[model samples]
Target chain A: MAEQPPESARTLIEVVPALGEVAPLRPGDPVRVVIRFPLGHYRVPLYLRGKTGTVERLVTPAIDNEEEGFGRNAGDRRYYYRIVFPMTEIWTDYAGPPHDNLRIEVFETWLESARHA
Target chain B: MHEHGPGESRPHDEITETGPPDYFDVLETALEELLTERNLIRPGEVRHQIDVLDSRTPALGAKVIARAWVDAEFRARLLADGRGTCEELGITFYDDTGLIVLENTATVHNLVVCTLCSCYPRPVLGLPPDWYKQKPYRARAVVEPRALLAEFGTIIPDEVEIRVTDSTSALRFLVLPRRPEGTDDFTEEQLAALVTRDAMIGVVPVTAGKDGSGA
Candidate 1:
């Protein structure tokens, strides 16, 4: 039943480093996964799109997985962050405790600084 | 698991030699011999590592959790860094994958899932369970963690928060289940026995039952 991942997920290849310099987001920074459904390779979950969360941990820079079809295993690198989002923020009918939340690693290319910066 | 190794002979052992053709057995033998001929991995080393992988189970993770429960300093080190801390306890990681230990407390209960793929802490918990990698579990774990936990016979009170962690990156997650009460006088080994695979995976909490079974 692992059917949630888009068809692009099956098309992803190896990792590749980006050729650029950028500041990595630190823990406690608010961020949101880019809300887009572009076809091809991407790691951001569909349910997490447009959702906001705080950076729980600053993971090391990782290779860009969005080769789509070309430049795979040779794309620019991006920093990864462990983003924590409340369940209430993810679903309208979240029935658990209000404090319940979700955490997932998101690439810099798939994320943007959220409001309340 | 009921199968025995080494000198123990099974009833079908004699017939197995001339029985059905196995693809993996031939492939593994060829690969191992070629690697050995190229001065790469030795056959003995390969056999030893096979044993290591086969022997690795949730017990290894359970032991680590038990140690964390008894020793504050070790627990702190485990929280700060999972790989180095496990290595400190003499647990060797076969690969470079990082292990991130998520602590469970009275306020928060942690659950782990790999929504995109079945990325798991194999070094600590061996292979991921079949259900963990399946599509339904992956799809629902994060969306309805409380419901999923309830399906697993775990009822988390409303006061306790549930933290669903999706292991989407290279680093894998292992839930450090809360230590059960009434075990203060229990030995470290006894505590380890009570810690089950489901508890370490955060689907359930560790219980203090004498009939400790299941991986």
Candidate 2:
């Protein structure tokens, strides 16, 4: 239960941002999540570390999770993408249908080009 | 603050069955007290926020879904802009979090989960159910969605592809379940009554009988 102050001075409806400024990693591009674990609060799930996935769509500009978790203002805006991973890729013994997939919203900083790996 | 080693259980065995206050509970109270003491936030702001959340329920989401089911134009608007559409129905999302409405089609099913934490669309669907925040639901929803859906009695056809969306703090998701059959003559109010929080969450589908009985 989080409460934000009323936006009396603001516009009635906030404009939703469109997909803007495609970076090196575009939708459908293969990418790998960084394996490093930083201290303090983080949004990247431990299970996704070192996993590769395809970018489904660009979601929004990255509002640094670490900064926000620490009660600080959002830092450098990076592109966040909706990445989809095959269940088999995430789990070695995935017993479900082969077509099943998992999609997660990941920030750019946590990803790297999967061309080499 | 004391930090427990990895995989170490909390030393609550010696305490009473009720045990001590949760560690995170103590931390949250301390943080709130500090913020209030410094005048950074009002004394009762936290309680006020909790009250605001408690005031919300699945009925609000049911109203939105009912409107969409009856009105094609409203359904289009809801698919395009979820927050704006909700606002049109007098439901304002005060927070900056963006709401995305996922539609369930005949061949496709959508399930939402937050593997990292419980990040739900509070404005529309209200607070999440207790099971949604648990680790089993969070971990299994993305990995074995069909099996998970079966546990909820939502048996999807083998041909239908199940799509799982992992929600985050920045973006929240609400599943726009397909309109149930045998309800063409039912009023919008009746349709709303048929809609449940679980239906909106995509774990179950809304069903109604011709006699307006519960499904």
Candidate 3:
């Protein structure tokens, strides 16, 4: 009988970003952000897409996945960047009171300065 | 954007031009593909499971947790091993694996998120809220838990050290939120009335509403 070919094993592969270090953001400056997933990378959030928001404050500095695992030390504390967005801009046709905004803590690397369009 | 490349026109070309779907949509696709390829589950079965899971998230489990929070012995059994104790109340949980129950303390609160994937207590808690699956909430909750709680209308004093637990492993979470004020000697049904889905997730405090008030 002819020899049988070896069977290929099937597995799910998820690509993640390499971590990196970065500077803090100015009040109006955009801080780059990245989404870290145990499974894989993802876009930061739906509400923030194509919308300009302000940086409220900086919490901690930890890792950036782009350059390498910049802040992924097993025991390192992560820095969270707080960003604010007007609710009306996010939820289309929202008929709520004016000036109701949402503040979301996004890590660095998932954001870029929105050049006024 | 007409970003399509030469190979992009091919149905198999998912890497370029074709952008990814929304968060929940992506989850739905992944689950569908997984089941289809494995033949372990069918589309109809998946929908059925989703419906079943959604219907299970009423105040049932929350009521049980509330009762345990008030009763020392029941609470002890709940703390010792939730699986055995849950059986006493006809609420069993084993979404194909063993279960663990963690109570919420005065200073600490627990919220579960399957950062790696959507690992939830489907049998006990049912479908997760839309916000739970968002990347922003999942990523932020672990790093800045208290802030996330505030977004959900929960405000804990600065003195309380809020701990945000990420459920990235096989283990699941059940929050035994602090008993809301003003309802001592409340019946089980009343206590259960106070338990809300948001409370179980630690986003909102368990409030004993009108039903929970001693009549």
Candidate 4:
């Protein structure tokens, strides 16, 4: 039999408290993707670079993809967010209805305030 | 028992020597053997975990969907806490990855894809299909969700907005397909039978026959 999680595991809703240097990005905040070409394994996709999107939700505080990918103990973690962008904004030739959108989970380091962009 | 004499070839030996050894296969074997030799992990435990994974299928997800359809409160629970709610039906999520269920509605359609690596809701939906892990799906699902979905034979209407979610992190997503129109009178088991693996993946919708039989 598969081992059952303890009764305390019933609390499935993850409540990530603000701590450390976590960004103040909240749900519904418009953010622009940072244009960075870091040399190493990274989670941010190439297409999303410099694109603008709204934060959908705060997912969790996770170790940076660089550390996770390279098995290094960089001792750094960032708040991950689910960001939603219009499909039209993502692809220039996107031939879809105007309301179509794409949601991507991204780390805090890849995002910046879109207000000035 | 037939024994291979000197200079004699066996059928199994020929098959083994024909192809180059896969890199991942060699790595996995070496790792497993090393761990077992170091008493870090038992081979039996590894086999048991594999068996657990092998036993999981889309049927388990279908059962959860069926129950959610018949029971309103269960649906609420399922939407609120997908991982915990699945455990109510004896479906355990062994991995720490969290599951979020997205509902398909009249005005909205939901499609899931992993743009990076294949981060799937394997606990509820079993292993992802080959196409789901392919480059075409990972690339196209994000840029042109509607076109990608249409290729899977799911044509969303113009009025309905399609939302494509890229599971890029620890969070995995599953689409809770809208229940078929005529399944109100059907039993949960029959309803479950109508819920195909593709339906849960949001590539298709559930359908029921007029005679109360599932399609």
- Give the best candidate by DockQ: 4
> Can you tell me which runs of candidate 2 are displaced by over 4 Å?
A1-22, A115-117, B1-37
**Chain A TM-score relative to the true structure, per candidate:** 0.73, 0.76, 0.54, 0.77
lDDT of 2 at A4: 62
Give me the overall lDDT of model 4. Answer: 0.83
Model 1 clash pairs are: A1-B135, A2-B135, A17-A76, A17-A77, A18-A76, A18-A77
Docking class of 3: incorrect
Ranking according to lDDT, highest score first: 4, 1, 2, 3
**Candidate 1 chain B least-lDDT 10 residues:** B1-10
Each candidate structure's TM-score, on Cα atoms with residue i matched to residue i, is 0.78, 0.78, 0.50, 0.84
Of 2 and 3, the candidate ranking higher by TM-score? 2
Span of ten consecutive residues with least summed lDDT in model 3 chain B? B1-10
Summarize candidate 2's per-residue lDDT along A1-117 as a digit string, tens digits: 867657885554577544433466888899999999899777888888999999988876766677777776744566778898987888888766666677788888899989777
Compared with the true structure, all predictions reach lDDT values of 0.82, 0.82, 0.59, 0.83
What is the interface RMSD, in angstroms, for predicted model 2?
1.6
Q: Write the per-residue lDDT of candidate 4 for residues B61-96, one digit (tens) a residue.
A: 999989988999999999888888999999988887
Root-mean-square deviation (CA) per prediction: 10.8, 10.6, 17.5, 8.5
DockQ of 4: 0.64
Q: Write the per-residue lDDT of candidate 2 for residues B1-215, one digit (tens) a residue.
A: 23232223446553477767778756876787788788898866776677678767899999999999999999999988888899999987868887788899998788889988899999888899999999999988877788899999999887777778888658888889988887888889988999999988889999886566644
Task: Say which candidate scores most in lDDT.
Answer: 4
Write the number of the candidate with greater DockQ, choosing between 1 and 3.
1
Error of 3 at A102 (Å): 24
At residue A25, candidate 3 shows an lDDT of: 64
